[model samples]
Target: MRILYVTTSFPVYSETFLQREARALIKAGVEIEIISLHAGENSFEGYPVIRFNKGSLLKLLYLLPLAFFRRGGALSAIAREMNVRKPASFLNFAENLLGFGAAIVLEKRIRDYAPDIVHCVWASAPAAFGMMAEALTGVRFSTGAHAYDIFEHGGDWLLQEKLKRAALVHVSTDVAADRIRDLCDSGKVKRIRRGLNALPQAREPRETCPSLRIVCVARLVEKKGFPYQLEIYRRLKEAGIDFEAKIIGDGPMEEEIAAGIKGLGLDDRVALTGRLSEEEVLEELQWADLLFHTGVVAASGDRDGLPNVVPEAMASGAVVIGSPVSGVVEAVEDGVTGFVCAPWEPERWVERCVELQVDAELRRRLSKSAREWVEREFVADRNTGYLLECLEVVSG
Candidate 1:
């Protein structure tokens, strides 16, 4: 079957769920093509990619006037605060007013390709464009809801209409599935957890030292709670705990986080490696004794929908510790696969880290259980198989 996957961006530095899913689909003997806004010149596991030029300059020009005069807040202000809000909202209005002129251009491409199903990754402007293309070409369409799509943009009437018309909808976790059911029909929603590529063989075993090493593989952002993790590290230092920490991702909050690390005198104990390739991440995982992830709901209400890092770390045989937010509880078994801490509690986080560091037997047990859990439930092949099954059923 020919499938057309639509998303906002492609082959970004941070590997997202859609990229992993597309790779898995190709491996599973499915014909897949992806169209997305251009990030850079990179191929996704040899899949065909069509990149659209993002009109950021034009968007900025359009937003400038609205920011100065509009009462409901200008597009510039909204865009500054949220990445998808202004551009998507403004583009949607433009598409509707112009009778889907931009969407018509995409529809021509879709008609030439003649896909059996159009799979959109998020409920944003791209999904709207995909919905229009499907209507024009008579192709079946579906969508996979992520945390930002469901919690941030799902309430838009146009997005809700697309959800109502889709043959099937996929969500990363049961918590997100429940929210989708509230917005649309329960029968149409399916829970398909995100997956990752298989873990590589460890290069070397962790060091046999009293001081344990912990790592957090996430972007430095407000939602990721990197500052809170820093606080936890500071407390660990004060308590004279023997451990090292590494953060392996880059984002907007890098400068602030660097300042924090310097002010707290954790320069020697903590290392901030900007970004690493997938192989590099797995290598670091092999060297680390444990994974410390303190994800929480941001001030803007953006929460976790079961981070892919959790499963990747687990599959790599690292004991996981995460916050008990929306979908994290599903991945972590609380003392079985990993430990769950309360959000924003640095003391609790430090306590868990210290306990796991002190107990070698517990770490071994949790590592074995964690690896088994991911192999059984969260492997990329198994998750994408379920997605393809849903597509077949939906398109029938």
Candidate 2:
């Protein structure tokens, strides 16, 4: 089968799940092509990529005239008010007008390639373009809704219409699937959890450290609860615990988190190692005694459908302690694979950290179980097969 995949951005550093799925599909004898907004490079794992130059200064200049003028509602409505005759063509005229122009080039490519299905990875902007392309070409279209796309971007009638038009709707967690089902048909929604490749041989436990090393692999954002991680670190310091905390990933909250680290005088104990490549992140996961994730709903109402980091950490043989929110509970087994803590309570997080810190046997048990769990359920091959099954059901 031939599949055309569409997404907002290409070569996103941390979202290896999408890359892994595409690779798995291709390896399974499916022909795949991806079109996305270029981030930096235009290459990924031998897959054909069409990169749209949205960052060009000329495109920004083109956007300037439309930026101040276009208001709310349907793009067709905005174009009608602006007296543009081809309103549907003028839709998405600002913001991503350049991408729309790129889509024209992409549509020609699609016609030449003639894929069996068009699969969009997000519901907001990409789905709009994918649906339009499908309508024009008569190819079957589908979408996978991540957290932000379904919860934040799906309230609009336009977005809802695009979703309804999809042959199937995929979500990473049951929570997200249930929510999307409320907005669309339950029969059309599929829950396919994100998966990770098996880790290389588990690292031997560190021999020299006096206390355990706790690591978190996530973007330094408010929703990721970086401040809460800092507070937990502070509590551990105050309690005179001998532990090291490291955070990997970069975002807007870097300065704020750094300030918290300084204010708590945890410069030595806690460190933020900006953005790391997947290899670097895996190295951290392999070395750490435990993975501490305290994800919560951000002020903007953005919540995780499921944080991919949790499964990756678990797959790498680290015991994962996560927040008890949304799809996190599905990833963690609480007292089995890892502990779940309240989002705001640093004391609870610290308690779990200390529990694993003091008990090597407990850590060993959880780590062994975590790896086994990932192998049994969240391996990339199994989950990607499930996704293909969903696609088969939809296309039929």
Candidate 3:
């Protein structure tokens, strides 16, 4: 099957899941191409990436004749669909309006590729291309709805419209799938996790340590809840817990997080290591006894759809303490797979830390269960193979 992937950007660090998923699909003999809305690397991992300028009105005008000749039915359908949904702001309105016009150009491009499936990675503006492509070419297309598409500010502007048009929607978690199902009002959503390949072997038990070692492996973003992480560590310190803490990964909130650590007088106990390589991240995960995910629903309603590091930390034998936000609930089973704590309660995390610090047996049991769960659910070959099978069925 030939699958054309349309996305809003290319070569993003946070969206590495897309690269991995495409690689897996290609490895299984499915031909794939990427259409990036924003200019970036021309290709990734040998897949040809076609750049479609999001604001190139001149190109839209140039392709008008070709777009019209392809078909007006898809164009009109998309226009009506986009019209019904309310835009969040003037900026959103302009973006979608431009995307709607650009769809004609996208429709022309997709028709020429002649792929059996056109799938958009992010369901917002990118999905507009898929929606228009399917409408013009009569080739079935689909969209992927992650956390931002489903929960951020009531989802993308064209989400419902594209959901109604696509052949099926793909997601990574059951929780997100449930929400998408209600919006779609159908049984069209498929859940396929973008899992890891060649995970490092689970870490050996602690040999020597500066007391209990706690780690948070996430970008320094609002959704990752860096502020909450600092508070938890502060409470841990107040409880006289002699723990060493590290916050791996970096983002826009670096300065704020550093300030928080200093304000809470946690500089001596906690350290921030900016973005690390994939191997380095796994190294940190393996080195720690605890992984804290104090994820919260940010003001924008953006939250994690099961950050890859959660499963990575679990597989590395670090007992996870995740918040009850978004996909975190699906992975951490309160006390079985990993402990689930609310972002509001810093003391609860401290209590878990104290318990794990004192009870190696309890930590070992949770770690064993976490590893087992990850092995069953988040194995790359297994999940990707399942996704490929689903695509084959759909393309037929």
Q: Number of the top candidate by lDDT?
A: 3
For each candidate in turn, the TM-score is 0.86, 0.86, 0.93
The TM-score of predicted model 2 comes to 0.86
* Model 1 misplaced regions, further than 4 Å: 38-42, 54-102, 153-157, 202-209
Please, what are the lDDT tens digits per residue for candidate 1 over residues 11-30?
67665667778888888888
The number of clashing residue pairs in model 2 is 0
Model 3, stretches more than 4 Å misplaced?
A: 54-56, 90-103, 106-108, 207-210
lDDT of 2 by residue, 1-396 (tens): 778888777768867788878778877788788887545247787555777765443543544344324422333442333342222322333423433344444555678888877888877556766665664466788988877665542332244566677899888888887777866787888888777655557544443447878898887777788777788888888888898889888888889888989998999998899899888888888888778888887765667778888878887777888988778888798889888888688888778877777677777788778777777768777888888888876766
lDDT assessment of candidate 1: 0.73
Pairs with steric clashes in candidate 3: none
Model 1 lDDT, residue 233, Cα: 88
lDDT of 3 by residue, 1-396 (tens): 888877777756667777777777777887777777765678886667887765566777667666666666656666677678687666556555555556666665666778988878878767766776666678887788888777878878877777877787889988788777877846788988878776669765563444988888888888988777888888889989899989988889999999999999998999998888777888888889999998988898888899988998999989999998888878789889889998788888888888888777788888888888898888887788987777678878
Ranking by TM-score: 3, 2, 1
Top candidate by TM-score: 3
Model 2 misplaced regions, further than 4 Å: 38-40, 54-105, 153-157, 203-209
Root mean square deviation (Cα) for candidate 3 = 2.1
